[model samples]
Target chain A: MKNIIIASTSTIHGSGYLDYILEELNTFFKEAETILFIPYARPGGISHDEYTNIVKTAFTKINKTVKGIHEFENPVEAIANAEAIFTGGGNTFVLTDMLHRNHLIEAIQNVVKNGTPYLGTSAGSNICGLTIRTTNDMPIVYPPSFNALALVPFNINPHYLDPDTNSKHMGETRETRIKEFHGFNPQPVVGLREGSWLRVSGDSIVLKGHLTARIFEKGKSPCEVEPETELNTLK
Target chain B: MKNIIIASTSTIHGSGYLDYILEELNTFFKEAETILFIPYARPGGISHDEYTNIVKTAFTKINKTVKGIHEFENPVEAIANAEAIFTGGGNTFVLTDMLHRNHLIEAIQNVVKNGTPYLGTSAGSNICGLTIRTTNDMPIVYPPSFNALALVPFNINPHYLDPDTNSKHMGETRETRIKEFHGFNPQPVVGLREGSWLRVSGDSIVLKGHLTARIFEKGKSPCEVEPETELNTLK
Candidate 1:
C-alpha cells in the first residue's frame, strides 16, 4: 500500500507538527524499517537546526532510522530506493528549486505513480498541483523554468494567515487579490489556510484543517466552508 | 498604420471615448460607417441614455456622424464587420463570461491579430493574457472557464493598489499574494496599478504609468521599478 503526507513543516520540527508526524509515521511505516527525509526546500540562510534536530529526536523516540537528505549527494537514488518517504516544507521556492535541479520532481512523481508511500509538508505539499500559479510567496528568485511536480490542479499557498495588527505595510488584500484572480479565471480556486492539509489515499481525498477555507470561482460569489468539505465536488 | 487605444469606457451612444467618437464621425460620410462596441464585458449595466449621450456628445463635439452597436444582435458579425471596435471595462468576470458565451474571444483575438485597432480599459485590460489568473476582483461569479484572450503571457491583475493607510488588515498583502504566484510559476508577472498601462505599438511595449510597478519571477526576489526602467525585456 502507498501512503503520502505533505505538509508546510514538521511543526517547526517537533513543535507545531507533532500530530502530523505521529500520524504519518504510524500510517506509513508500521512495517517499514526506515523513513527517507528530504529537507532541501528550506532557504540556505534560514534557521532549521531546531527543526532538523526535532526530526532526529522524533525518530530516536520512535526507534526508527531517519536519513537526512543533505548527507546524500544523490538524493534521487536515496528517495527512489526508500520504502517510504517524508517531505517537510520550509520555503516552497527554495524547495522546488532543489527538486528541479536534482531532476527529482519527476522521480518523485514516478514514485507516487508507482504506489510508493509519500509524506509532504508546506513546500512539499505544494509540488502536487497542476500548476503553482496560485502560491502566495514572493518570487524572490528564479529557477530553470516554471515547472513543478503536477500533483494537484491549483497552486498551494502555505503559511496562509489573515493579516495581523502589529504590522505597517501597504499592499492589496488577499481577498482582493483572489477576486482579481477570478476576473481572469473561469476556474475554481481553493484557498487552504494554515493547520490544514489534504490527505489522499488512492482515489480518496480528506481535508484536515482547523478553520474554514474560502473558495473562489468565475462568475459566482465566494463561498466558505469548514474542514469536512469535499473540494473535488466543486468541479 | 495600426494604432490601438485601450480605454476604460465608451459611450454606448455618445461624450465618452473622445477618439472613438471622432473616428466614427469621419467614417459616417466616408467609406467607414460602422463601429464595433463590446458591451457584454460591462454587464454591471450601463445607462442607455448616458451611453447614447456620451457617443452623441463625442460626435457633436467633433462634428462627426456615428452609429451605436445596439442595432446588431449577432456579436460575431458585428465585430467581424467593424471598421473599429472599443471594449469598455466594468466587471472583468462578467465581460469574460459574455465574450465566452458569444464565442467572441477567439474572434477578438483574430481581430487584434489582423491589426485592427483595439481599445480597452480596466476590465477590458484583463483579457490580454495567457490566463485571467491575475485580475483584481472577486470570483463571486462563474464564467465558462478560466480562459482569457491570451494576448500576453501572464494574467493582468488590474485595478491594483498599495494600501494607502498605515494600518494593517487581516488579509494577505498583494505583494505576498503575488509572491505566491511566483512559488508556482517561473513566468514573469507585472502588477499594473490603476492609471497604469502597458501600451504595445508595433513591436515596442511601453509602460505609461508614472508610478513604480512591481515585477515578480519565480525563484527570485521581487523588485519595484519606475515605468521607464528595463522592465519590458520580459518575453
Candidate 2:
C-alpha cells in the first residue's frame, strides 16, 4: 500500500508556505518524526540549504523535523531510511534533471510504493505522474528523459488554470496546451487547480480538496469531476 | 546579409491570422515569389496541409504563393532552393523535432544567412534562438536536443506577459520563469510582447514595434528597451 498527498501547489494565494494544508499534513505525517526533503527544484535559484530551511520551518509547526536529502552521504540510502518524504515545488525541468542525474528516481519510487508516507507539490507532484510532459515549467535544463516515477496511472498538470475569458493574451491556454499534449501523447491528464490535491492510499485515489478537477481523455471533451471523486480509473 | 522577421505571435487578440503584420511582410518578402511554409508545429493537432492552407490564405493577400515543406519530397532540398521561408507558430518541441529529424536546421540557417528572406512567428521564432529553453510551450514531445538555429544572439520568450497584479494565481510569473532560466543559462533573453518583432538585417538586429520589449541578461536586473533599439550587442 502507498500513502501520498500530491498537491497542486505548496503555497496558495494569500497563504503562508504550506499554511493552508498544515492540518492535513499533520495527520498525513503523523507516523513520522522527521521528513526527508528533496530541495533540488531550487525555486528562483535558491540554494539547497535555503530551500530546506523553508521546508523545515513549515514542518516544525506540526512538530515534525525536516532534513534535506543533500545532507546525507547517499541520497538513495536516505530515501530508503526515511519514515516520510516531502518534495516541494519549483521548476519541473530542474527537478526532473536532478532526479535523473542523481539516479534517485527508482529509489524514491520503490520506497514510496512500499508505504513510506510521501507528499509532493507542484514540480514534485509532476514527477509522481507518468511523465513530465504536462509540466508548466520552462525547459531551463534538459533531463536525461521525460520518464517519471509513474506512481499514478496518468499525467498531472499542476497549478492548472481555467481559460480567462477577459484576457487579451494570445498564448495557448492551459486547456489548449493539454489538448496539444494529447496530439502526441495518449495518456489521460488531470488538470489540478490550486488548493486541490489527490490523496492516494493503497489502490484508491480520490480528489481531496473543495475544487473540481478537469479531467482530459485523449479523444473526449474535457469534463469537470467533483471533489472526492475517485480517479484511479483515469487511465 | 540575413533578412528575417521574427515575431512573437502570428495572431494577436481580436485579430485574424497575420492581419496586423501583413503590410510589413509585403515589403519584407517583396522579392520572393513563393514562400516555403514549415507546418511541423501543428497547432491544435491540425494536419500539415490544413496549417499550410491557413498560411496560404494569409500570404495570398500579399500576392505570394505558399507551399509547405512537407509537399516537397526532400525537406532539406526544399530549403536549399526556396526563395523564402516562413515557419508559423505551434509547438516548439514538435517544430524543433521535425527540423532536426529532416536535417533542415543547417539548410535553413545557410539559406537565411545568405539573404533568402525568412519569417518566424511564436514557435517558429523560438527556433531562431540558440536553444528552445525559453519557450512557454508545453513539452508534449521530447526533441533530440534543445539546441536551435542560433540565427540570433539571444533567446526569445515570445508572447511575453507581465505579472498580473489582480490575479490570485500563484504560479511563477513570466519574469520569474526567465529569471530562473538565467540561473543555468548565461545567454540573454528578449521578452517579446505580442505584436513586437525583431528585424535582423546582416549584423544588425533591431526591435520593431510600438511597445517596448523587456531585455533580460544574466546577473543584472531586467530592463525595458524601446522599439527600434538595436539588439545585436546583447550576447
Candidate 3:
C-alpha cells in the first residue's frame, strides 16, 4: 500500500514552499508525526540544513516535525525507520549520485514499498519514474546509473512546457526531447507541468491537479490526459 | 597549434544548414580536399549517413568533399588521418559517450591539438570545453563521464539563452541553472548564444559573431563578452 505524491515543482509561482500542496500532504501523512526530508537535491545550491529548514517551516502547518537525513548518524537506518519521507527538488544528477553512493536506494525503496508515505517534487518526482532520462535539468554531475526508484512504471518530465510554436528558438522542445528519448527507450513518459502531480494510492496512480498532463508512448502520437485521470490504464 | 571553430548551433533562425558559418569554414579548410564528418551527435534523430549527406551538400558549396566517420572501416584511422574534421550537433551525452566508448576522445584531441582544422556546432562545440556539464540538451543518455575535450580552458554552454524576465514559468532560468552549476563546480562557463562562436587559432581563443556571450565563473558576477573579444584572458 504505497502512498506517494510526485509533484512537478515545489513552489509554484506566487506561492510559498509547499503551500500549494500542504493540504494534500497533511491528509497524506496525517497519521505520521515526523518526516525525514531528503534534501540531497539542494535546489539553488542551498546546503542540506538550509533546504531542510525550508521544509521544516512548511511542515509546521501540518503539525509534523521535519528532520533532514543528513542529521542522522546513519542515514540509511534513519530512512528505514522514518514515519514518512520526502525528496526535494534540485539537480537530479547530484541527488542520484548521493543516493547511489550512500547505498540508500534499496533501503528507501524498501521502506516506501512497505507503506511509508513518500513525497517528491521536481527532481524528487523525476526519481519516482523508472529512469531519469526524461528530466529537463542540466547534467551538472554524473550518477552511476540512470536507474531510479521505479516507484512508477514509466518515466516523468517535470516542469514540462509545451513548445512555443511562435518562438524562433532552435533548441529542441520538451516534446521533441521526450520523443528523442522514445527513440532509444521504449518506456512511456508523462510530461507533468508545474502544479500537476501523480497521486499514487495503492495500485491506482491517478493524474492529479488542474492542468492536463501529456503522455508519450513508443511509436504513438502524444496525447493530453485530463486531471483525475487514472494513468495505470494508459499504455 | 589547435585550430578549432566552436559554433553555438548548426542552423540559426531562418537559415540553411551551416549557411551562416560556411564562409568561415571555406576559409578555414581552403587547402583541404576532403573533410571527415562526425555525425555521432545526430540532430533530431537523423541517421549517420543521412546527417553526413546534409554535411556533404553543404561542403559542396565550398568545393570540398565530405565523408562521415561512420563510412570508414576504421573510425580511429579516419580521425587520425583526416585533413579536416567536423562534429555535428545532436546530443552531447551521446556524443561524449560515443567518443569515450570508442576511445576516440584522445584521438580527436590529438589531431585537433596537432591542428587539423576542426569545426563543431552545438553538441560538437560543447565538447571543446573542459567538460560537457553545461550543455542545454536533455540527458537522453548517461555518458560514462561528464569530461569533454578540455581543448579549451573552460566549459561551453552552447545555444545559451537569456532568461525571459516576464515569463511566468517556474522552472529555473538558464542563468539560474548555470549559477547552480557553479555552486557544485568551480570551472568557468561561457554561454554561447546562437550564431556566436569561439575561434581558436594557436594559443589565442577569440569570441566571434555579433552577439555577446555570457561568461560565468565561480563566485563572480556573469558578464557579457563583446564580439571579437579574446576569451583566453578570462578567469
Candidate 4:
C-alpha cells in the first residue's frame, strides 16, 4: 500500500510556505509524531539546514516535529527509520542527483511502498512519477538517468501554466513540451496546476484540490478533470 | 577568427520565421552561398525535413541555399565541408542529445572556432555557452552530459522573461532559478531577452539590440548591461 501527497507547489499565491496545505498535511501525517524532511532540492540555493528549518516551522504550526535528513549520519538509514517523509520543492535535477548519489532512492521508495506517508511538492513530486521527463526546472546538474520512483503510473508536470495568449515570448509552451516528451516517451502525464494535488491511498488516487488538473495522453488531446476526480480514469 | 550570431530566439513577436534576424544573417554569411542547417532540436515536435524546409524558406529570401545535416550521407563530413552552419531553436535537451549521440559536438565547435560562421538561436545559442545549465526548455530527454560548446565564457538563458509581479504562480522565478544554478556551479550567466543577441567576432563579443541583457554573477547582484555593450568586460 502507498500513501502520498504530491502537490504542484509548496506555496500558493499570497500564502506562506506550506500554509495553504498545512491542514491537509496535519491529517495525512496524523499518525507520525516526527516527520523527516528531505531538503535536497534547496529552493533558491538555500542550504539544507536552512531549508529544513523552513519546513520545521510549517510542521510546528501543525503540532508535529520535523527533522532534516541531513541531520542523520546515514541518509538511507534516516529514510528507513523515518515515521514519515517530506521532500520540499527546488531544482529537480539537483534533487534527483542527490537522491541517486546518496543511494537513497530505493531506500525511500521501499519505505513508501510499505505505506510510510510521503509528501512531495514541485520538484519532489516530479520524482514520484515514472520519470523526470516533464520537469520544467533548469538542468543545473546531470543525474545518472531520468529514471525515478514508480510510485505513480505516469509522470507529472508540476506548476503547470497555460500559454499566455498576450505574451510575446517565442519559447515552446508547457503543452508543447509535454507533447515533445510523449514524442520520445510512452508515459502519459498530468499537468498539475498551482493549488492542485493528488492523494494516493493504496490503489486509489484522487485529485484533491480546488483547481482542475490537465491530463495529457500519448495520442489524445489534453483533457481536464475536476477536483476530487478519481485518477484511475487516467490509467 | 570566429564569426557567430547567438540569438535569443529565431523569431521575434509578430515576425515571420527568422524575419527579425535575416538582414544580420545575410551580412554574417556574406561569403557563403550555401549553409548547413542542424535541425536536430525539432521545435514543436516537427520533423527534420519540415524544419529544414522552414529554414530553406528563410534562406531563400536572402538568396542563399540551406541544407539540413540529416539530408547528408555523413553528418561529420557535411560539417567539415559546410560553408557555414545554422542551428535553430527547440528543446535544448534533445538538441544536446543529438549533438552528442551523432558525435557532432566537437565537429561543429571546430568549424565555429576556425571562423566557418555560425548562427544559433534559442536552443542553438545555448550550446555556445559554458554549459546548458540555464536553458528554459523542459528536460524532454537526457543527454550524455550538460557540457556544451564553451564557445563563450558564460551560460545563456534564452528568451528570458522578467518575473511578472502580478502573476500568482509559485514556481521559482527565472532569476531565482539562475541564482540557484550559480549556487552549485560558479559560471556566470546572461539572461538574453527575446530580440536581443550577441554579435561575436574574433576576440570581441558585443551585445546588440534595443533592450538590455541581464548579467548574473556568482557572488554579485545581477545587473543589466547596455545594448551594444562588450561581453568581454564580464569575462
Q: Which number leads on lDDT?
A: 2
lDDT per residue as tens, model 2, B1-235: 9999999999988999999999999999999999999999999889999999999999999999999999999999999999999999999999999999899899999999999999999999999999999999999999999999999989999999999999999999999999999999999999999999999999999999899999999999999999999998899
Tell me how far the alpha carbon of residue B127 in candidate 4 is from the true structure, in angstroms, after superposition: 0.5
Model 2 chain A: weakest 10-residue lDDT segment is A95-104
Question: Residue B212 error for model 4, in Å?
Answer: 0.8
- Please list the residue runs of candidate 3 whose C-alpha ends up more than 4 Å from where it truly belongs after superposition: none
The ten-residue window of minimal lDDT in model 2 chain B covers: B96-105
Model 4 steric clash pairs? none
Q: Which residue pairs come into collision in candidate 2?
A: none
Q: Candidate 3, fnat value? A: 0.68
| Tens digits of lDDT, candidate 4, B177-223 | 99999989998898999999999998798999889999999999999
Candidate 1 per-residue C-alpha lDDT over B75-97 given as tens digits, one digit per residue, 9 for 90 to 100? 77777777766566655656786
Give the least accurate 10-residue stretch of model 1 chain B, judged by summed lDDT. Answer: B6-15
Winner by DockQ = 2
Interface-residue RMSD per candidate?
10.4, 0.6, 1.0, 0.8
For residues A92-145, what per-residue lDDT tens digits would candidate 2 score against the true structure? 999999899889999999999899999999999999999999999999998999
Supply candidate 3's per-residue lDDT for A143.
88
* Docking quality tier of model 4: high
